[model samples]
Target: MNDDELVNRLKEIIIEEEIDIIIVGEPVTLAGYASEQTQKSREFAQLLEKYLTVPVKLFDERLTSRRADAATLGATMPTRNRDELAAMFLLQDYLDKQKSNNF
Candidate 1:
């Protein structure tokens, strides 16, 4: 879906799920350098902030895909499933960091 469609869908989900915030994955190189995808992610986050009621935060997603692949090494799954797993890793990391900061 396009950005407009994505924004509309996210808005619906935020209300339907009563989500307080949105965590977006920020893809960067292993060396922690910003790449083209990182720029795209930032732009998308800006778009989300402009259109959505919930706050949008970007979290480092480096190595998430690799971790997902390792976690599913022996399993056979579609690419989309792997992508979803990577997203889970990203969100979990974000939450973990938030929890640590609260202490």
Candidate 2:
């Protein structure tokens, strides 16, 4: 999805879920370096910070998509994309941090 679509969708989610924090999946390469998409994601996170009252952060998304794909690849494959898996991983990381911090 484009930035405009993402921003709009995020707004809806925030309103619906009463979300306190927006954790974005950081796009990193296999070598643990930032990918080209990192800049775009960071920009998106910045934009989200401006529009939403909640805090926004970029959580490392390394191997999450791969792990998700691996988990499903063994079974009947669902037609899921990398982005969805990556988003799940990012959300999990945020949730874990929240749990630790008692947020």
Candidate 3:
């Protein structure tokens, strides 16, 4: 989806689910490397903040997408990587980090 569409969709989900926070998945490259696409995640966070009432945060999404891709490859059925699962991993990773820092 495009930027506007993504923002709209996130707003809808936030409203529908009464979500308190939005954590965006930002996958780095192998061995914890950031790439040019990382800028897009920042832009997305900015758009989300502008459009939504709730807070949006970016979390290190390293290996989450890769794990999902591996799972799809291992599955018996012909499945593909899912963005939602990646998002879930992103949120969980953020939560884990917060707990680690006592934040």
Candidate 4:
């Protein structure tokens, strides 16, 4: 979704669900530099922050889709949304990082 569509969709979700912080996936180049897509994500996050009351953070999304594909390679029931799976893993990684930072 474009930033506008995403913000609109998130507005609906925010009204319906209790949310604290937002984590955005920043897909960097393999060399750890920001790519065009990463810049786009950063800009979207910036725009999102302007509309949101909660904090928004960028998390590295290196190989998340690949990992998601690997994880669900053998699934036969029905194809799950790979994007959602990647988001789940991304959130888990962010949460884990936050937890460790407390130590």
Off by over 4 Å in 3: 70-73, 76-81
TM-score of each: 0.95, 0.73, 0.74, 0.84
**Model 2 poorest ten-residue lDDT run:** 74-83
RMSD of 2: 2.9
Residue-by-residue lDDT tens digits, candidate 3, 1-103: 8878877888888788989988877767767777778878877788888888998888888878666667577554433336666666777778888899995
Q: Is candidate 1 or candidate 2 better by TM-score?
A: 1
Ranking by lDDT: 1, 4, 2, 3
lDDT of 2: 0.78
Q: Which lDDT tens digits does candidate 1 get at residues 30-87?
A: 9999999999999989999999988999999999988999999848889899999999
- Show pairs that collide, candidate 1: none
- What are the per-residue Cα lDDT tens digits for candidate 2 across 13-80? 88998888878788778787876798888887888888777888888787787777775674545546
Clashing residue pairs found in predicted model 3: none
TM-score of 3: 0.74
Predicted model with the maximum TM-score: 1
Candidate 1 error regions (>4 Å): none
The TM-score, computed over Cα atoms with residue i paired to residue i, of candidate 2 is: 0.73
**lDDT of model 2 at position 86:** 57
Compose the digit string of candidate 4's lDDT tens values, residues 1-103.
Answer: 7867878899888778988889999999878998899999999899989988888999999988777888888464333588888889999999899899999
